[model samples]
Target: MTDVRLAERPELPDRLPLPVVDNHCHLDIRRDDAPEVALRQVISEAASVGVDRLVQIGCDIGSARWTAAVVDEHPALLGGVAIHPNEVPRHEAAGDLDDVLDEIASLAQHPRIRVIGETGLDYYRTGPDGVAVQQESFRRHIALAKRLGLALQIHDRDAHDDVLRILVEEGAPERTVLHCYSGDMEMARECVRRGYYLSFAGTVTFRSAKDLRDALSVTPMEHLLVETDAPYLTPTPHRGRANAPYLVPHTVRAMAATLNTSVPQLCQALSDNSEHVYGPWS
Candidate 1:
């Protein structure tokens, strides 16, 4: 097992212990100055909290390759390959987007690279020059995921309609996941009705996330998933610090409360939902 430090100390409850899978994370973004050490720490901390598996996502070619290497080393971790919408312009201009996409496609052939994304639109950050590029890039990623018959993990930030429209228009892969789902109840219901998976991140644990809680309350247990989005959304007590997979249980507890279920039951449902969307846990 790897040795990693906890991003924050989580108070574990005794009665509701359950295995968890962090459906989304950026392991590649950790300190590259000592990647092995950092990764080891991440693994150790996650395992401590019953996080049996983690899907490590990469947003560009370098990050993708790095994440694949991590997956190669750790059997419990899986890799996700894609270019973030914000990075499209730089990649396209460098004439490396195709090469990157090709590499990602080839990487997906690996047993551990189980999903394709962190891909989708970010209209919240789009300028005129970036908007067209983002759309085209998002379309290409969608088409690639569809063609490869792989699970697609989407990141829609303040561009829900466009994101949903493109997915519907392009005939999104049968297995589609909205990572860190930030939509309201209507959108949640629509996603559930369409048989899509919604992954809740640490944001759902925040006291200010009443809308997210409302959405979670209405979402069917079978269609819901939970994640830390680690190295990012760290959940309540750990907020303002770098997030990690071990903190996922906090989000799980929050989701359980929202769903009016026990943590064990919620965790089981999340495990089933994750496996259904992304296949058997690595």
Candidate 2:
């Protein structure tokens, strides 16, 4: 079940003509509330903003099930399964990963399970001791996604080179995505050149994120996606408030400005990119 605080229903506009997609969120982590109630709240909030589809991430075994359940309830929601880097040690020590991976693999066969991650390196959060475990887990998930022909959603933080090196070396699936891409302009260009999708979040809307804006400006429209990363990184006008999928438009607006395009155009491009990565959820 989702947390009440994270799943509050949002007020949508009366007429929502634009098309949008929340490419990343943790519907499975909604603060300790009933799953049904949380899902209803999320659906209502997203629908209000004309968001036709959402790809919710399950960063662990339990959340993976929750994500699948939510997708079952809300046809517009999709699921991705993997153990987040921070959670790898616990999963390994508990001897719970095999069951988790087996369950996730089985769940990936579902039509709504479109991707196999939100998984990758996070050196900033975990020190050197966690490196081996993180890498082993990352490679395992990558191998699974490759074998299953599923999209791989990566979560890289301050470990761009290692992540890229591993992906390149292992020949990651063609439909890989870098969620909340926080790398420099050069890395962004390299990722685009290598045919990876770059999904931006609310951080793009911050006043001091000139580098990120510059990176967005240079990235091609076909390889770009936008997300809220909700219950976190809320965009302007609601910077301090808890974020939800409904706030995607603010990030979309900021992306459009950065790319020197109209909101409709940006939305169209992002929706197209999303469909390419996760297949058409709608």
Candidate 3:
């Protein structure tokens, strides 16, 4: 497990005006003082703040297995399974990529496995040598998601053009999402035009993220979603602290301000868009 610690967890933001879902998060990543305790604490705190549901994403074999089982224990949680783009090269080197993918395919059949994702291209991390492997894995995942009739969550990082190209070339699944959407206004418009969802994370709240805010301003409420991607990208006012689903209210409120809409209106839209993408959480 990778160690993740922040000076302290942020205090909960004001309760949301309406319930919304955390469309993407990695709860299995160890964070906070005690992981198990922190996990429950985050869930409780999130519910108290009107973040009523979450989609836990597992990008590797172990976390994918953990997610499949964990969702069974929590009424408010669902799961997504895949091998992250950055991890594709490692699995390929080990010669176990195909086997692990088969396992993920099996895990996808679980009732609570509502998504197939946290997959896509990441040019920022993977080198030229690893790009082919990542692209190949991404195509396989796209096919898996289409076959299973599940939502597809993409992790695009510094590879927006290629990611979009590949999606078009392979025919994107009906419900594709750009998790922690980092593109500008033009890209955002293109994605929305294609019927894909753009999920904003706390990164949009940073002062340096004017482009992200601009994208949010142009995005229609119907195609927008919100996420924490917690234990990372903590919103301002809590940037240095550990992020959890409870802190989602901060990002939601920021997005509302950018969109010139009321928090309640945005929350309702987010909740609706989430259901539209992932289906009913129940």
Q: Which candidate achieves the best TM-score against the true structure?
A: 3
lDDT, candidate 2, 105-179, per-residue tens: 887787788899989999988888889989888898899899888999999998999999999888889898999
Off by more than 4 A, model 2:
1-17, 31-37
Our model 1 lands, by Cα RMSD against the true structure, at 4.0
Name the candidate, 1 or 2, with the larger lDDT value.
2
- Per-model CA lDDT versus the true structure: 0.81, 0.83, 0.92
Candidate 3 Cα misplacement greater than 4 A, ranges: 1-5, 32-36
- Against the true structure, candidate 2 has what lDDT? 0.83
Please give the range of 10 consecutive residues that has the lowest summed lDDT in model 2.
28-37
> Candidate 1 lDDT, tens digit per residue, 106-215?
88777778788989988777666877878888888888778777788999999999888988888788888999999999999999889888999999989999999999
Count steric clashes of candidate 3: 0
Give model 1's TM-score versus the native structure: 0.91
Candidate 1 wrong stretches, greater than 4 Å = 1-16, 31-37
Per-model root-mean-square deviation over C-alphas = 4.0, 3.3, 2.2
Report the lDDT tens digits of candidate 3 across residue range 1-282. Answer: 433446455677899989999989889885555245356777888999999999999998999999999999998999999999999999999999999999999999998999998999999988999999999999999999999999999999999999999999999999999999999999999999999999999999999999999999989999999999976788887886667889999999999999999999999999999998988878
